[model samples]
Target: MKPLHARYPFMAGAREAVQEASVDLAEVVATDEDVVERALERVEWALTDGTVGDTRRQTRVELLSYPVARVIVSTVDEHICTRKYAQAEAASAHERFVEELETETELRSTRQQHLSLDALLAEFDLGTAVRETGDGFRVTVGTYLELAADQWGDEWRLVNRSLVDGEVPVDREELYVLLKQAIRHRVVDGLPLSVPDVIAENLDEEVERVRETLSNMDLTTEIDTVVPDLFPPCMKHLLDQVQKGEHLAHHSRFAIAAFLTNIGMTTDEIVQLFEVNPGFGEEMTRYQVDHIRGDTSPTQYSAPACATMQSYGDCVNKDDICEDEINESHPMSYYEHRVEEADDDELTDWREGAGEDGDDDSDESPD
Candidate 1:
C-alpha cells in the first residue's frame, strides 16, 4: 500500500494547501458550493495523464485523502476506469462508499429484456407490493410511488401521469420508460459527496504534473490537424461523441482507433485521444489501442466498412462532408485518397500502410 505522497508526488506541495482549505471549508462552501466541480476539472487531468500504464500509482488512488477527492474521483473513475465511483480504490478507514453499478443502475436489466405486465408487477418495488386490478395497477399514498406520481399530467416525472390512489391503467411503453428513468437516476446520483471545500492549489499542481508527463512522451508521428475533418461521418460522429465524454459502442471505438492508426497517429497519441472519453479505462484503452496498432500480434486490421458503422448507430445525420460522393466507400479508402492529396511536405514522414497498417512496420491484412 503506497502512501499518498509516493503514489501522487505532485500532492507533496499541495498537502498544506489542502489542510488550509479544509479549515476554511465552511466559508468556501457557503459562497461557492460548486468547488466540487472545480476539483473534478483538475483531478481528471492529473489522474488520466499522470498515470497511464503505471499500475502502482493508479492502484493507490484509493488512499488519497484530499477533500473533494471522492466527488472528483467519482466523475473520473466512471469514465477513466469505467467502474462505479470508489471513495478509495480500496476500502477506507473513513465511511466506505461502495457504488455497485449493477444493483444501483444497470444499463441492461433482466426486467428490460423480458418486460411484461405480470413480470413488471413482480419487480415494480414501490417499497410495497403492486396492487393489480382488471384495468391497471393501484397506487396508494404513503408509498415511494407517491413521490414519483406527484408530477402528474404531461411532463410528469413518473411514466403514467394517470396514476391514482385507486386504479389507473398503465401503458406498456410508459411503464418501460419509467423503469428506465429509475435505473438512470441511481447511476447518476450514486456518487459520494464531501461537505467541505477542496484545495484548488493541490488540484492545479497535480494537473501540471500530468501535463509535464504527456509533453515528455516521445511521440514521433505527426498527424495533420485537418485530417480529422476528412474522416467519414460515422467516424467523425464517433470521435465527436467520445470527445464530448460519451461512451462509444465497441465497433465505433475499434473503428476509430484503427482508422487513426492508419492515418499516421502513434499509439501514445491514440491512447491520449481515448483518455478524453468518459468510458476510458487505462488497461482496456491500452489493450485495444495496442491490438489495433498490431503491437500485440502481426495481424494487420483495417477500419470497419461504412455498413458496419451504420449498424453501430454511429453514421447518422450525414453531414455535408460525409455525403461527398468520393468517400462513399470504406473509411480507409477515404483516407487513402485524402492523403494522396496532402502536401508532399506533410507526407515527408509518411510511408505506405503506416496510416492503415497501424505502424511503420507493415503486415498484410487478411481482408
Candidate 2:
C-alpha cells in the first residue's frame, strides 16, 4: 500500500478541512480577553458535551481524526482570537466556532475510509485468531486455501507454503536494493512510506519503473564549438588560460565567474570558460551561472578568498601581492603595496632629481 498522502484522495480533503477549521476558529474566538475567555468556555463545553464527545462515542474514532473538534479545542488551548463582544455577542461567537468545527469534522469524517485490519481480514476471508509475535502476526491456513490464495495470503499457512521451509528467509542484498527503489518510488509519487510492510512490498520493479518514468527527460540544447562564440569575453580569456596550462583551481573559476558576471560578462564568455577549463564540470559551471543570474549578490569569491588568506596567511607575501610573492605574509596587503607604488609612480617624475640636475637644493644648503 502507498502512504496515505499518496494513495488516498482524502489527503486533499483533510488539508482543506484543517484550513477551514483554522479560519472558523479565528472567526469565533472573541478578540477581547474577557469575551474570549467566556466564549472559549462555552465552546469547550459544546465540544466536550455536544458534538465532539458524541462523535467519538458514536464512531469510536479518536478525537485527533476529527479536524473540527481538534481545531477548536486546540485553538482554545493555543488562545486564538475571536471578534465577539458583550454577553450576547460572546454566546453568538461561541456558537459560530462550535458550528464551524462540527461542520469541518463531519466533512472530514465522511470522506475518510476508516478501515481497520479486521475489516481487511474479513474482505480477504482471512482468520484473525492468530496472536501477534515479537516479529509479526502469524496465522494458520490449509493447502486448499494456498492453491486459491492471491498475492496476499489470507493466512500465514498459505503464505508460508510459498516460502522455503515454511518460513521466508530474508535476503539482505535484495532488501537493500528494494529499500533504495522504495525510497525513490515514494519521492516521485509524493507518498510517505510510513509502514514497513508497504515499503517492503512496493520496493520492486514496479516502483522503479514509475520512478524512472517520472525522472527520465533531457532539458538542454547543445551548441557546437571548441570555444563557443556565445561565451563572454572574460570567460573565454579564462578558458584560454586554462587550455594554455594554467592550473585553475575549482574556486578560481567560481570566483572569476562571479567577478566577470558582476562586471557584465556575457553568456558566451561563461560557456567558453567551462569548455576550456579542465577543472570545471559542465553542471557545476551551469549552477554557478544560475547563481550569478539570480538575486544573490555578485560577491561569492571575496568570502572564500578572505577565508583562504586568513587560514594560510604565511603562504602569501606582504609586498607584491602577486601569487609568486604570496609567501609568509598577507597577499592582499602585498597587492595594496603594489597599488601604492603605482600611485606614487604616476604622481612623480623620478628622472628630474639628483646632484646638479636640481639647483634649488644647493641654494637651500647653508653656506
N/CA/C clash count, model 2: 13
Residue 214 Cα positional deviation in candidate 2, in Å, after optimal superposition = 52
Q: Which candidate wins on lDDT?
A: 1
Q: Model 1 scores what on Cα lDDT?
A: 0.45
Name the top TM-score candidate: 1
Per-residue lDDT for 300-358 in model 1, tens only?
Answer: 57677777777876667665544677765566656555554554335333221123323
- Structural similarity to truth (TM-score) of each candidate: 0.31, 0.20
Instruction: Give each model's clash number.
Output: 4, 13
Write the residue-wise lDDT of candidate 2 on 140-211 in tens digits.
Answer: 323222322211212212222333323333233322222222222221232121323332232233233322
Worst 10 residues of 2 by lDDT: 217-226
| CA lDDT, every model vs. true structure | 0.45, 0.33
